[model samples]
Target: MEKLLGEFSIGLFFWQTVLFLALLFLLRKFAWKPILNAVNDREEGIKNALDSAEQAKREMENLQADNQKLLKEARAEREEMLKEAREIKNKMIDDAKEEAREEAGKLIAQAQASIQTEKKAAIAELKSQVANLSIEIAEKVVREELSNKDKQVKLVESMLGEATLN
Candidate 1:
């Protein structure tokens, strides 16, 4: 310790101080300036990247909302179409039933008319047959009575008597 203190010289110390100050000046000019600039540029790039990420997140949220809205609209449209189809189906069934009822009514009316016409024709034929039978029976009875001359004469005499009294 005593030798180090004894060797400490003011001229050597002054020269060392000058050299240290020169080196510090050169380092500040060449190395520190570039290092600080690089750090500032890195900070700006990170900030820009964070801002872009935030914007992208906002855009993604907006797109999700739009997709949800579109899905809801599609569901509503599908339900509406189904409802309309069901209504159309029911209407078609009702129309078919009504047409069937009309056709049945027409067929029934035609059958009833045909039956009435047949009944009238049958009644007319029966009347004609009965009249022909009655005429034939009366002719036979007249021929038999005429064959018996005495009976025919008595029948004629009675008819004459009744006529004269009236």
Candidate 2:
């Protein structure tokens, strides 16, 4: 115990102090700068990552807005197409009705014309029949009057006297 206590002296204390200071200098020169640089780099990487996340979020919002706008445009275009189709359908129906009316008018006119032609033909036939009957009656009367020879001679002398007076 006496020798152990005696071994603790100022020379050992001085050597220990020198060794501690040298180790501190070596560590400061080799290790401290690298450790601080590593910490700064990690901080910078974290900041960049956060900024990238914010930018991506903004881009997503813009994309969503664009999608909504496109959807509205598509709906409007579809409505317009539906309206046009309805208009076309109405026009076609109107055209069909007009065509039907025109065809009916033509048919009526043709029927009226045919009736008029038939009536005229009937009237003409009646007139011809009346003329034929009149001619037959006159021929019969003339034949009966001429059947008597004395009456025919008196008729001939009266006719000749009327002719001389004319």
Candidate 3:
């Protein structure tokens, strides 16, 4: 009976080895192959997502740089416009001042000419009045002298004597 049991144990060991080898082959063919493929696909998906995130980050940085450049340009343009406005303001002020000075000079000149004309007119009027007064005074003196008939006759004879000598 011990000999038969030993022989039966050898047959059992043989059957167990065959079943274990068959199970390992079936798992490799169905379960292990599918699981490895699934893990590889997930790894690829993760890698692609990380790549997209990196690309998005780079694009955002580029956009920010572009915005900064545009801002600088805008600030420069504003400064240029302000500078032009200030220059125009200054030019306008200078022009206005110059025009005012010219206008004032013209006014002064016109006033002086007007004064000179008035002075000349007043002197002419004074001379005419003096001439008229002198004429009136001479006429009065002659009338008084002529009021004496004897002196008038003597003056007439002297005038007639001078006329005959010519």
Candidate 4:
């Protein structure tokens, strides 16, 4: 132990401390500034990259919202067009039905008018036939009675006696 203590001399310790101080000073002046500058540059690059990524994310979200709004507007316009088409179709159907009903009414009225005219014509024809038949019957009866002149004179005398002047 005494030998080991003896080896730790003041001169050796002072030289070692001097060398360490010189090395520390040299490293701080020549190496430390460039290394620290490199580290700071790398840190700045990483910060810029992170900021750009955040900006890109915000832009993508805005674009998605715009697309959704456009889709909703398109759907509403399509639905409105469909509703208008349905209204037009219903109106056309109603107009067609009304036209058909009017045509049918006109046809029925024409048929009734024709039937009334034919009935009047038939009644007129029947009356004419009946008048002709009565005239023929009266002529036959007068010819048979007048064939006998004596009987005709006796019939005329009886009619004259029953006749009134007024």
The top-ranked prediction according to TM-score is 3
* Model 1 residue 138 lDDT score: 48
Off by over 4 Å in 4: 1-30, 134-166
lDDT for each residue of candidate 2 in 1-166, tens digit (9 for 90 to 100): 9998898899989999999899889988899888889999999999999999999999999999999999999999999999999999999999999999999999999999999999889888888888788669746765887899988788678867977984
The count of residue-pair clashes in candidate 2 stands at 0
Model 3: residues >4 Å from true position, as ranges? 1-21, 133-166
By TM-score, is 1 or 3 better? 3
Regarding lDDT, does 1 or 2 come out ahead?
Answer: 1
**Candidate 1 lDDT score at position 84:** 100
The window of 10 residues in a row where model 2 has the poorest summed lDDT is 134-143
Q: 1-166, model 4: which lDDT tens digit per residue?
A: 9999988899989999999899889988888888898899999999999999999999999999999999999999999999999999999999999999999999999999998889888888888887688658746765787899987787677757856552
Per-residue lDDT value at 118 in model 4: 90
136 Cα displacement, candidate 2 (Å): 6.3
Tell me which residue pairs clash in candidate 4.
Answer: none
Q: How do the residues 44-116 of candidate 3 rate in per-residue lDDT, one tens digit apiece?
A: 9999999999999999999999999999999999999999999999999999999999999999999999999
Candidate with the larger lDDT of 1 and 4:
1
Question: Which of the predicted structures, 1 or 4, would earn the higher TM-score when compared with the native?
Answer: 1
- Candidate 3 global TM-score: 0.65
